[model samples]
Target: MVAKSAKLTQLIQAVDGQKVHQIRCGDHRFIDVTIVQTQGRFFVRQYKFSKRSWYDAFINNPTIDGLPNGAMKIGDLEVQINGKVPEDLQSMTPSVNQAYRKLLGLVYPLMRLTFDRQKHEATTLELIPVFDH
Candidate 1:
């Protein structure tokens, strides 16, 4: 299940304007990530497939101590994963690409390189506020 509308709003507001945040997985692991919001949905992309301990940890043990599979933290805000959102590799919107490039501050060739890397190697996951019970 996705977050309740109000909680989702709050979560989006909390993270608004922030490009990078720490994502906590398992009980004591945290990794710095760049978060992007497009169409009012939050996404985190793994730039390098080689460095995927965090992703591995989340997938292998998404939750601990009775938490949901999606339970995780972004910065100080608690959130849940909505699994991996499908990326339309062939049709990435300009705005979305721009958002990522801005967050990364990459120049022409580097931007192209990173974008290609993302297309070929990275995983994009949608994040939602933890559902309220």
Candidate 2:
């Protein structure tokens, strides 16, 4: 794991309680994402197969112009991505997943987010923080 810089730590604390935030993949436009912070790490799960562009983007090219290709922006602070979490440790806790489902219901009342634990577990991606130099 990369050491967390003061800026990165502050950014994590600032958004840890929030259910949703905007993330940008490479040069793609920012998209609303459900983020969760656990074990001093941040994670984003692909709730649906159709919404896998961000994941695909990262896998295709994790870096661009020698800089990280992904980022999560919270106001003026941006947390750079180190890379995806390994498959073995990608799954979030059940409670965390339940909370995410509740958040989705509140955030998108018209849309129904399914509760397929297996699928969600497979889609979870940890946002390893890139420490500032």
In terms of lDDT, the best-performing candidate is 2
What clash count goes with each model?
Answer: 0, 0
lDDT of each: 0.58, 0.65
lDDT of 2 by residue, 21-75 (tens): 8787776788888777655667677765664577766766756444666888766
Residue pairs that clash (backbone atoms under 3 angstroms), model 2: none
User: Candidate 1 lDDT, tens digit per residue, 1-133?
Assistant: 5447877777666656566666655455557776666667666666656655556555566444444445445556776554344455335445456667766675534846545754633455555444752
For all predicted structures, in order, the TM-scores are 0.63, 0.70
Error of 2 at 37 (Å): 0.5
- Clashing pairs for model 1 are none
The C-alpha stretches of model 2 lying farther than 4 A from their native spots are 1-4, 63-67, 90-113
Model 2 lDDT-worst window of ten: 107-116
Error of 1 at 95 (Å): 5.4
